[model samples]
Target: MRFDTRLVHAGHELAEGTGDVVPPLHLASTYAHGVQDPPAYFYARGENPTREALERALAALEDVRFATVFASGQAAGATALATLAGAGRVIVSDDVYGGTYALLTSSRLDVRPVDLADPAAVADAFADPWAAEALVWVETPTNPMLKVADLAEVCRRAHARGCLVLVDNTLAGPALQQPLRWGADVTLCSTTKSVAGHLDVLGGALVHDRADLHDLFTTHRTTTGSVPSPFDSFLVHRGLKTLSLRTARQVETAGKLASALRESPHVAEVRYPGLPGHPGHEVAARQMSGFGSVVAFRYRADVAGLLRRSRYFADAVSLGGVRSLAQCPATTTHRPIPPDVRLRLGITDDLVRLSVGIEDPEDLLEDLLQALSPS
Candidate 1:
């Protein structure tokens, strides 16, 4: 089956005897075991039927062999570093998510920030002696800034030096982009965002094609007890069915919003890969199926007032939900980074990040325009 068809049927097996179409939500923490032969699932921490279904669906969507689901995106990230990074340095994109920034900086890993959007900078970073046996972390169409990286180039450079590459695929879920196809060794995602579609579920996943990496991540998840609940797994799995549809509408709306923002006199700058003016537009066009649903722009007027006046867009943090969300990255998502450092990265106080939802495009656009217009 194709990608969209697989989304509906990948992990679904009709309930035995009942012939129910939807997969059953298995909630049992422990399964019955015999003396001679142990059960496939003895405990929930190591295994759960519902969670396994979600993992299978995730792996199928990424066109990979394995996937390990986590309680949160941070847990998945921490496990990826712990199991794969070894004792070598970890090179990350400079415009990474605040949680990711804090995770590497606070840990013992030798974390170095590199401008991953620039191929020359990536080449230079990999040339460094410290980069040998390192892990290169990438977040394309990166958090808040919407900067897309050249995945194939970075993967080529990193693999040339025997280094592994992990891509945070939260901003552009599998429906829009599959990093493994572009040579990413592992794809990390916040299932709490796009994968779940609705805002209710909180989970994460790391999808890859290697059995060795899968075994390592699964072991870490089991040992650390960082597994998602059966219900969260069910929610995310259900969300998978509509991913292609939701992403398409959201991407269409996002392009409209980006174009509108650029024309707004109250807006200073607009950042969206769909825009030809964006630095990473070409690479994004080549790698991703769609430009994604997030549109970020620098508001020339009061950011707080804009947030307060918007009727449809919620003043919130997370993205890829059914409802539109607006946030000031300098204060919300990227607050962990120092002001000076954030300024250097173009994350100004006036920057407003919008996660375009499945709402009517005209309504969303009018709300944004009125909010940005003189109060």
Candidate 2:
């Protein structure tokens, strides 16, 4: 099945009793099971019918064999590292989500940041003794900065060094790109953002093709208790039905907004893979079906004023909601990073990150134009 068709129908198998079109939310904490007959699901923490359904759909969308849902994006990310990478050295993209940076740096693991977009830098990282049996953490079209990593090249280098690669597929989601298709061992996504669509639910997912890795993640999740609630799983699964449609609208709005922002004198630079001048434009074009919905740019005018003047966009953290959102990453998402490091990554105070929603293109464009205009 195609992406959208799989989204709507993959997990919607009719129950023998009710024959409901949607997957029923199984809220049972524990199932009735006897020693003589073992059930597939015995407890909510270990297994949930609703979560299983959602995982099936998620796996189908990514064209992977297995998927595990989590309570939150951070939970999934932390679990991926703890279960797979452990105390071993981990090489991550220098420009990544603030939560990711915090989680890695605060952990006992030897976490090193490398420019994953640069093939030479990645090769050099793998050359080091520390890279032996190491894990590579990559974020393509990286958070806030919009830097795209060459996934295939990095994965090849990591595997050659007997290392594993985990690609954060949150920004692009399965609608735009699938990292496992590019040879990544695992793909992590914050289903809270794009997958859930609405701002209501918080969830995360890990998709991969390896059966052994799937077993490890499943065991870890059961032992550590990081599974999502049945209702959240249902919500995310429901959101999947409209994933392609919503993503298409968002990409259209974002592309228009990026082009318009680039023409404005108030903008210093625009960073969207769809933009011809963006460093990762060619790479993103090659890897992704769409450039995604988020747009990052350096604003020359009062960053505070532009945020305050916006009517359609809410100045907030997190992205990929049905509602448009905007924020200065230096102060919001990437604030956990040190001042110098943020500057080095080009996440300056004037850098405005906009998460375009499924709004009318003309309205979003006008809103940005008026917000960036002089008073």
Candidate 3:
């Protein structure tokens, strides 16, 4: 089946007894079980029918054998890192999500930050003797910076050195990019954004082919109880049914806005992967099917003021919604990152990130124009 067909039909296997077309939210925390009989589901923490259906759907969508949904994107990320901590030091991209950064820095693992776009630097990082046991973390079209990593190249280099590669696919959802196909061992995302895209739900997920790693994360989730609610899982599943339609519309609007921003004298740089001048445009072209809906640009004027002045876009954090939003990474999404580190990663005070929505392109474009005008 095509992707759309899969989205709407993959995990929806309903028996005649429960003739409801939509799956019910299995909110029962515990299921009836007897010691003499084997139980497929004895506890919600271990498994819930609603979460299972969503996981199955996501796994099919991401082209992976397994998936584990979490309470939040950070919880999924932290679980992946924590599971691998005993293996060796973890290396992450410089523009990694601030929450992911906080998770690693607070841990005992020697979390190293480097430029994943620099193949030579990545090779060198994994070449160290310690690299034999290392784990490589990548976030292409990274957070607010919008930098793209050569996921295929990074995976090749890491796997050659016996390191595992995990790609954060939140910015470019499965509708646009699938990292596991590029040799990444695992792909994770905040389903809260693109998957449950209406901005109505909060959930995270990890999808991969490896059985061992699947058991590891599943055990951790079951033990720690960081699983998402059944209702949230149902919402994520529903949102995915229309993901491709929403993403395509958002990406089209983003390209138009990015071109306009690039032409502005007040703009220092526009970091849309669809834009030719963006450092990651070519790499994104190579690894992704679409350039995603988010665009980041550095402007010469007061970015905070620009965000506040925007009429169409809500000045807020978080992306992947039907309504457009603008935020200054320094004070919003990436604020948890140390100022110096943020600067080193090119997240400047003048930088603004936009999450394009399915709104009319002209309105979004005009809103940006007015905000950046010399009025």
| Best model number under lDDT | 1
TM-score of 3: 0.97
**Candidate 2 off by > 4 Å:** 35-37
- Better structure of 1 and 3 per lDDT: 1
Instruction: Judging by TM-score, tell me the better candidate of 2 and 3.
Output: 2
- For model 3, residues 196-282, the per-residue Cα lDDT tens digits are 889999999999988998899999999999999999899999998899999999998999999998899999888889998887889
Error of 2 at 9 (Å): 0.6
Ranking by TM-score: 1, 2, 3
| Candidate 1 residue-wise lDDT, 1-375, digit = tens | 799998999987898899979878888898888742645778999999899988889999978779999999999999998998885689999999999988988889888999999888988998888888799999998988888899999999899888999999999999999999999999999999988999998999999999999999999999999999999899999988899999999999999999999999999999999999999999999999999999999988889999999999999999998999999999988999988989999998999999999999999999988899866
Question: What's the TM-score of every candidate structure?
Answer: 0.98, 0.98, 0.97
Determine which window of 10 residues in candidate 2 has minimal summed lDDT.
32-41
TM-score of structure candidate 2: 0.98
Query: Which stretches of model 3 miss by more than 4 angstroms?
Result: 34-38
Q: Score candidate 1 by TM-score against the native.
A: 0.98
Q: Count the backbone clashes (under 3 Å) in each candidate.
A: 0, 0, 0
Candidate 2 global lDDT: 0.91
